[model samples]
Target: MNLAVFPRRGYVKDPTPIESCPAFSKALGGKVNIFIKRDDLLPGCAGGNKTRKLDFCMADALAKGADTIITCGAVQSNHCRLTLSWAVKEGLDCHLVLEERVKGSYKPEASGNNFLFKLMGVKSITVVPGGSNMMGEMEALAARLKEAGRTPYIIPGGASNPIGATGYVSCAQETLQQLFDMGLKVDHMVVPSGSAGTHAGIVVGMVGNNANIPVSGINVSRTKADQEALVRKLARETAQRVGMSGEFPDEAVTCFDGYVGPGYSLPTESMVEAVRLLAQTEGILLDPVYSGKAMAGLVDLVRSGYFAEGSNVLFLHTGGSPALYAYLDTFK
Candidate 1:
């Protein structure tokens, strides 16, 4: 695939790595060898998976000669945090539309990404009710910017569009190369499925490369049925963008929604334990919302013998550790 034909500004040439997690592997009782692709270490301000998407999204914005960026996400969103980070790097103004997916979570003085947003010098913020039309809200922001004489670009939430997802397609290719070098064959890969870009892109990359390894998504929000449909749709779109042939079969999009307790970003007992386990045993930190719940699901599945003995399970560590600081009270 001619992935280089796609625009990629403000992007690092290489992905992070698929490294051995001795701490986590030991914690799982050696039933399944656990490895992590440290996407959290991707070079960016505070770093996270969103950096990959923004590499493509921001590239397109720059190509279009935009001076300002507008995007939407839940309050304390890692995607928003990374978006503002990239905006600062590219010297573009950023405006955010915060969705209160959980009511009363949008405190202006809140810590974590909220504090970072201000520190990064975001131009403006619009707080929207949960489930509002995000596209409309972002367009309104762009119109307001234009009225003020700023050329604005709208990047969709999570940057889950096909172009943005190309980042992960590249990631999939990188992972396959890493596996070959390390002599590690991944039986199953697990990742947190929130906005679907990472999940979708990985699916396309794996399918296109004929890797044949299944990628399972642990949904942080939405039901299994709802999340799978979204993932499959995005995967197909992403595959088409990269000029990959064939449809991603519906059966390939697997998700377990059992870990999303209460609602999005609301912590669950399993999530809490998962975070603690990673911290204490693996010395790795997982955020409250996405990776923590996904790890919980991964742990349960491993214990349930979902994979045969000696199977190597790969976990895509799409980072959000900064969000952990905001939930100090929950952790305490």
Candidate 2:
């Protein structure tokens, strides 16, 4: 889809690598050949998938002549950390509205992304209760900034809007090209479904490019039905935003919620196993919240024989290993 027609801040110059994980695959009985798209290595303060979405979102903010950036995410949000990082690089003041999705989860003295927030000098940090209206909170913050003579631009949570989702459309294209270059024929793909930006963009990108890869989302928060619907809606909006025409099939967007455990950011035994398995087997670290849970889901799916024997599956590693420090107790 000609994503070049859209404005981007050019934060990502090269595509992340796609590497085989024989050991990890073997751990799952080697029923499928597994490959990982290392998006966790995307450029940012700590590296993450959000850096891609921010590339487009930040460009939009700058284009509108914004002097300050405002965004929201959960406590220890990789998105917030990356947004603040890029804002610092661009000489823009960044404010964050963090939601304690779990009650009492926001700790002022916490490590991980929270510590990075302070270390990077976020202009302000507002912690909201779980299930708070995040956009409303951001709008209020923007209004206050306006009253203070600051030009504030608000980026939605996870940058899941059409403009931000275009970053993943670009990533989808890059991944397809990489697969082609390597002569790899991936049968299925997996990603984390949270704010739905990453999952939605990949769905739209695959459709737009006529790639036959079916992307499955491992839900970190919502139920399968809700997450699938949210992702499908955003995928359609993103496709339309990128000038893609025609109906996006409802069947295209799929999600599995079996791995969310008790709730968002709550530790699960499967998540711990997945994190340790990858770290030990591949020397790769996955953050506790998103990627770890998604990997847990992937591991379960593989064990359950979700794919045909000898199939090829590609997992999108969205990255957030920095948050691992905060979950030391959980991992322990």
Top-scoring candidate (lDDT): 2
- What is the alpha-carbon lDDT of model 1 when measured against the actual structure? 0.89
Lowest lDDT 10-mer window, candidate 1? 10-19
Candidate 2 residue lDDT tens string, 40-126: 999889899999999999998999999999999999899999999999999999999999988888889999999999999999999
RMSD of 1: 1.1
Q: After superposition, which runs of candidate 2 have C-alpha atoms over 4 Å from their true positions? A: none
TM-score of 2: 0.99
CA lDDT, every prediction?
0.89, 0.93
Candidate No. with top TM-score: 2
Model 1 clash count equals 0
